[model samples]
Target: MELEDMPLEKKRDGDGEGTSKLVVEAKAEGKQTEGNARLYLTGCLFFTLISLVLMLAVIVLSVKSQTGSKDCPGTGDDGRCWNIFPKIQAQKLDCHQCGDGWLLFENTCFYLSTVRLNWSMSQKNCTAGKGDLAVISSQSVQTFLTGKAKSFFWIGLKHDANQWRWVDNSALGVRYWEDNLSNGDCGLLRGDGPPLKNWMRASCNSKAYFICEKQHTSLLTILWTTFFMYIKFCRIYGGDKKDDAKENLSSQLSVELEGERGKQTEGNARLYRAGCLFLTLICLVLVLAVIFLSVKLQTGSKDCPGSGEAGAGRTSTSLTATCNFDQCQTDFPDIQHQKLHCNQCGDGWLPFEKSCYFLSTMRSTWLMSMIECTTRGGRLAVISSQSVQTFLSGKRIGLFWIGLERPGSQWRWVDNRALGDSYWDDNLSEGDCGLLRGDGPPQKNWMRAPCAHSAYFICEKQA
Candidate 1:
């Protein structure tokens, strides 16, 4: 019977015999299903761990981007990190820096300092930083500051102006102080201790560093303060004068900005014009090139000088060179690199010991003939002209050679044109060559002997 059709107990226990196998078979199947469920739970936990790690990586990247500092502070209103740096606002201007080194009370300012430097150098450094030394105006304010100012300090008081003066060069007034001195060229504090509030003068050279202050009064604040002072129930006296002053200051600021912008605009215009001209010139050149190419195509090659004829002209010209460089090489091969003033050669040949040669041996290839010189240290016998050659040829009782050659071969020489037409004496009539002989009836092959041959071996050397 089919497994599905059979009764459950019969299939599991197989016929009956009191075996009880059906219940054991069912328990085994239940255990297999439980194992599968446990595997699925383990796989889900691993995937969950991977998702958590990826989420953490994204958060760390976001925090780093936000906290990084790139641009410098104090650059226009974009400095949104105002709270992180010291900021002071007065009127329409905003100034942010470290902090004010000087303190102000009532109408006057004061400072207490520690380190000290020389007078001139200290003034320079402070000016560079846009501040100056302390100037004590009133006796009470001075006394309070100096009492707290323990160490020696410099002040803006000086007698170098031909008389005593404060930082701004105004004469010291006795109205604000209990006492005053004409030549008080130095600065110090009064002896009032608990808040010893007074100013005194000591030596300026004594080492000290003092405080300085710069103040800017807001237009709004000034207006309110003035209004409160002159209040006749808001009658407001002198408001017109204050407004006129404010307007003047604003106008001056605008003028300065306009001047700066005018210069910048003019510079930009010049740069733009230069760029436009450069591009226009480039376009013009390209158009001209196209026109030139069209003209060449329409004309014959010989007329345009650009078709295949250009190459033929080069080869033809090279072959047609009758004499190199416009001169008859047979007569003046060594004439180049010469003084243009040299209209002609010097008088008769520049005769050495026994032969005639050109006065221009200085231009000859001395290196080419070094191996072919004679025992007496003579070289390829140079002849200034046919007359000199004839004399050398006829006078040689023994055969001597001159620099003459056949159509091809070593530059073997013969005793002038008068030597026997048979140039059989030369080693090979085919390579760069030369010859040497002594004064005598024509002899042959003697030219190939080492020019180093002893002087006694030849007629010229026999002497």
Candidate 2:
């Protein structure tokens, strides 16, 4: 609502401009007063608009502060909408939070993953964990999982029992598995295991570790031993306290409980934020990758098979099937990318253009970045080729170092190459644009925007 819409304490400035002092005036004439009211109304409208913009900006920032990360599928507690972070509506029930490739239904985790191990070993492991090969019944679960794994595995069902039986020994429900037309076949999913991401068929003697599903609920409730419960019990039993005393106690208790809750909440919030940020970073990487892949797919006509692990900074050439969290490792190694090259040259450097570029460590004036890069026996990276441009294109959105800047604010190329016209963003000339690391400017479609703005910097020197 506009401020003018509500009656406010009246105040007005004197007509004199330079003589600034506290002064209030009331109109004597009705016509003049009406005019004054109109002016006030107009001012109110203008101020209201400005207020609205600021409020919206704050709200957006607030939302970003809370929800600024990627979405996760579970929160141990029941979810609340006002939470700074949001959880994925679906509960992830994988063994040890191994999210994407496994499914948890009922009290067990089922391997929707296409990982290969002997059917028997997989069964024994699942049996040890109180679950068995997947006995999927619902179409939704099947569709949700099979879409990713795109293959099948030996489930708990086997032919030795002389009947279609699940490893759990429970009566088989309606099975939605599309048959391969084998009459004596046991339960099987159409998938091969790790490294292949393909399909295979075999007996139950497989020795792979089975993924068992469990509910999102923790093992047991310790609420009775918790601080909140203790406070409640104390409130009910403490009778001799005065009403005011009781209230004070309750308030203090409430604060303590809230603080405790806040601690958990904040902890979860931080976790959520971290998860989200990681996810956001992942998604951003994925999106850029997808774009690049799509481009590569178009150019290569789907003939050049790319390795996901190789793309993720692994230095090995072997096709790795899974991630190893103990060490920051991915599947394929030996495949080379510009970023991988930088990874090859450690100490906050990323490889690009057959040269090492420093990571963005802190924002500095262009002069500062140049000096630092120079100290490292390099200049700010000036991306010169399509290969370099494409490599940098896949990086996170930020201002980063490049080997270009205004010397004496002349806005000339460092190489002293004769120029036909200056290439800069926003029509900025030598004076307005100042300096650029990339030909494109900050947030420009092709330009990385600014250099040395993030907490990291990239210094590059020729090989």
Candidate 3:
């Protein structure tokens, strides 16, 4: 109650003091907030700087590695380079130079000599140059050498043990002898002649230009380059540890895939072999079944009704027994005689009387024709009768050889029968062998000709 009665100055002073206290407290809170903002900004700047430095380091390392790889040498005129890694370099690297004036073909270097030399001297010169005489194994190689050879050239072929063989003890497969010559022991390439008639035999002492051959190099440098390129590609794609892990995983996956492919291939091969075996077995079974059915049918056909014992013995009798169609028709009334008569002649012969005749359609020498007839258990036709001569003359359309020959001064048959009556067109005793001349009359169809001449002949056998 006493404070309420006091003047407004006292109230004003109290209010002023409370206002000052609130202003001071707000100023302290503002200072604390500003200091916290500065600390947070400084931490953010530090983190960004650290990240930038790490990225710069990675870029510099990558550039250096690229530059070093690009600096590798040996990539000269051919655009090929040697591998830096010793392990990679050891694997089938091809780094050879075919010397000056030498031509490279496939994996071999060839040198055509300009100076002429004997075969022995030329081979010696080739050996001195770390090569050997050119050995032509294929047509393409022969063609190449022929084109290069401006003159006659000595080859690696030589006659040994009565046969042509290569210098390296290999036998010749294809021959290109000119005119089938059997004169010289050494082989030569006649470059001046046509391509087909380029090879000929010559004396070894004859002087001629020659060819030399040696291995060039293997083609494995490309693989080495590919390996290094793969490594560079991995390094650029990802950082060291991560990319290494990725590459390892990729390698493992590739290995697994390759293994799986191999297994699949093996499985397919096994399946193919099994299928072939199964088909073979099925075919064998079918053949056996057909044979068994055929045997059963044959057995059933032979078993006549009410003739069980006799039918069983028919197999032994059929081999030596001659079937008389008249008797068969009387005994078995159901049997047909005409069908039985059709099977009298064996297989491929024309039946006339009791003998079968095979007409001549192939031409051969007289001696060769006789040999063929003898193989078939027959001989040339012996025209002892006029009817037989007429039959042979009527069927022939050209001059055909017979068994008659004049081995001595007299004409005789191949079976040593002397010539009885002469049916010659003239008394011409110039030739030695007899032939059935179809161009003349049938009565005088016999003529003499050389035995070495080729003509068709007839063969006769019993039916």
Please tell me which predicted candidate would have the highest lDDT against the true structure: 3
| 1 against 3, candidate with superior TM-score | 3
Leading candidate by TM-score? 3
The TM-scores of all predictions, comma-separated, are 0.24, 0.25, 0.30
Backbone clashes for every candidate come to 13, 47, 0
RMSD of every candidate to native, in Å, equals 46.4, 30.0, 33.1
Residue-level lDDT for 343 in candidate 3: 30
Residue-level error in angstroms, candidate 2, position 272: 40
Sorted by TM-score, highest first, which candidate order results? 3, 2, 1
Ranking by lDDT: 3, 2, 1
Candidate 2 yields a Cα-based lDDT of: 0.40
Please write out the lDDT profile of model 2 over residues 161-193, one tens digit for every residue.
556666556766655444344443455555333
Off by over 4 Å in 1: 1-100, 107-109, 175-184, 190-203, 216-463
Please report, in order, the local distance difference test score of every candidate based on alpha carbons: 0.37, 0.40, 0.57
Query: Candidate 2: misplaced stretches above 4 Å?
Result: 1-114, 127-131, 177-180, 183-185, 191-202, 205-212, 219-463
**3 Cα displacement, candidate 1 (Å):** 99
State the TM-score for model 3: 0.30
